[model samples]
Target chain A: MSAELRRLLAEVAERESERFARTHPDDDVLLYERAVAPRRALRRTAQASGVAAVAASVALGFVAADAVVTDRRDATPAASPSGTSLTPTGTGWTELPEDSAADAWRVSGRPLDAFFVPEGPDEAVLVGADVTGDALTTCQVLDAFARFQMLADAAEAPLPEAPLSSQRLGGFHGLGDVGVYEAEFTRRAGAAAYLALMVEAAQMCRQAVGGAAVVNVEEDVAFSAVAGGGMRVDISRDGTDPWRLWVHVQQGRMLTVIAEPGGADEVAPVITSYFTAWDR
Target chain B: MSAWHGVLEELIRQRRSALVGYAYLLAGDRPLAEDLVHDAIIRTFSRARRLENVGAAEGYVRRAILTLFLNNRRSRSRALAKQHLLVVPDVAPPDDAAGDHDVVVCALNGLAPRQRACVVLRYFEDLSTAETAERLGLSEGSVKRYVHDAMVHMRGELGDIDPGPEPTPQSVVLVKGGAR
Candidate 1:
């Protein structure tokens, strides 16, 4: 039986090989240029920009978690040198209106508050908050945990052996129904690893969404690096309305902030505000 | 120009079709098989491995292809999610002229990714159980079980069709204590 199966497989393989060779006769120089060259260029760019050094430190497990956390705490107070008020008064941020219960509902009671929102005519509200340690895993496990697990297994990184807890926040986005999630990990190394995994997952998610046969749902994932040391993952499902997802691993905490549809230009301020609040 | 690039070009020029054929056996799709080959090439060349020759390069690419296929079982679930959109009619009688091709391919596809990989490495690639285990990062016992289970499934699918009295190859002799 085994021999027969082998013979059959060999026959099929031969037939398929001939057919594929005949059909795809052209040389794949384009594949090499597209896939291999960009990776090489990216490596050179990383080496030049000093990002490679930070990656090496994280990979070596030599990053000090305490120092990162201390830096964040120190940076927050330094922003307000007088030490009188923690919240920014003239930062173009306004307190939520008391009667605007619906808008408040969009921002209130999340793990974090609406310290930052999109600065445009459309009222973009804060949708997520800072959840640390196990809370981060609990919030994101259903959506991206399998990807994290696969990446960790591939890299041989052992995850913390703690039970993940979950809390589902319910509400509808001003544009459409969008989900906002936030989480922070305890260790900088783990956070850094997860950040890398999230980038890869974003790429895979983009492919999955593009390949999905579902009609009338335009899904996309656009990932890019922020100016500082973090990455932003933008996921758009509704036509022309992108749901922005920001992931920052700083000060020994991994922060993921997701927001509903707003102007793309408004992303930087929100990130800056979140980091400022996180430092405090 | 680079050593890896030269080796990659040579491997593509020489072994691209063979690699695609191997991937097609695992993926059971033409376009996906080609994608797997291309992805495997990128994965192999992205890392600075010491590929001394085209043979060594081919070996690395093959391993990468296998890894990519096994890791991408998530696509199976995505396909299942979209199965609702597919309309199925009544089953037709098996085509006699097509021989056992459909039976074999369908049986191969029905097996779990790892099980199918084990069967391919065992029968198609003619590797020993230990070699299959090493390639798949599984224990020898696990490889034996997967191969055994795969053969049992194939046997059930193929039914009692006699394969004539052809002699088994020497490589098949090494796969002892499993499915024999």
Candidate 2:
């Protein structure tokens, strides 16, 4: 590097450092603890449990574990099955893996990925979407979701009491009159970002009046068997379409299931079957 | 907390400014840069229980910061691309009022993430090609290519303006936002 270049770099670095110090002069310790303590506790808990706390729950068929790991080896991109239009367009949208869901829903959109709409007997569509950008701003993400729902406005649908798990990502699944919805099934960089978005959603939900918003974050994750790196399911309401339940799962990736609100007994099987299709 | 924890905490307090600056270069935005550094420090301390060496701890944290920035950038590209698919106009106005220092920062930002990282690591941190590659999980050749491309970009954008002698501490006035 030239002498001038080095001087410029140093100047920029020094000024930037000073700006950070001035703005966050007192946050070093608090930020450190907030970032480290929970992670350390999670690590200790995982160590004590032997296997991941959530992976064990996956064995019970309570939730679908193991992020996008299932689809990596199956490089064979199948043709879009009978009912869906899941073409891998040039715009970088990955082809949806062949799944039972493919038989019933047509998928569209990029990044938001698959926006499924049921084609035959299936009552709901599955949307595999992701919130990506410079930062995953909660308001922006919620806005995008709301914007996409151009039909009836999506209000903050109250999250049902979800089974809590000790996995890297929280997952939720629900089936009721409010409309079945599951969200945050795929893991991301970490659970902190996931939790942050959820908190933002909750706050927005609390502030929303007369259900003006499209989706709402659920509350009360039941804290028991939900303790593995397994996925937890949270249900949000699609007020625009109440008979159809919306499932949004975000872990490292995102998987959503929109199904007709059905019996409580049918919730688990329906969700697991969708996961099976997602994996296939 | 152990005595080691205290040592780690003290080290963080002392070097937080430098770490935040390094992250800001990578993340372009101030708040996101702070979040990256914060997460990197937490990750380093949480994983390395036996923090016998503060220097190595700093290095580990720096690497974590780079990885976090890169991962977020990659994910953001996909999301931004997808958002573009929604028939929205995504145009950013060029910096018209950038000062000399702001110009330098903007030039650095223009490079692709990997190339920009190479410049920061190789030139700013004074890391060797081998070390940069190892830290980035890339081969030395790749690091060299990135640095070469970055330098070409810097030279093109920076031209040959003389920055004069390094300003003394008292001479340099620290302002609020720079190259933001």
Query: What would the per-residue lDDT of candidate 2 be over residues A147-184, giving only the tens digit for each residue?
Result: 12211111112211122222111112233321122333
Could you tell me the lDDT of residue B23 within candidate 2?
88
Residue runs of model 2 more than 4 Å from their true location after superposition: A51-280, B73-98, B161-180
lDDT of 1 by residue, A1-280 (tens): 5667788888777766776666656666546644454344333222332343345335422243344344554543323112112233332223433334443322222222333332211122211222222222222331343222222122222322111221222222333333323344555555555455444434433443442211121111112322125556554433345555555555345444455565333334334444554321
Top of the candidates by DockQ: 1
How much is B64 displaced in model 2, in angstroms?
0.7
Provide per-model DockQ scores. Answer: 0.22, 0.19
Candidate number of the best TM-score: 1
Residue range B6-93, candidate 1, lDDT tens digits: 7877887878888888998898776677767877776677553466699988988988889889777335543453334222334532
Tell me the TM-score for chain B of model 2: 0.71
Tens digit per residue, CA lDDT, model 2, B1-180: 445456567767778788888887777676577667766776677662677767877877888889878777334433342232122224533333349878887898899988788777776787776677777777666666677667767778988643222212222122222111
Model 1 - which docking category?
incorrect
> Model 1 Cα displacement at B14 (Å)?
2.0
lDDT of 2 at A60: 25
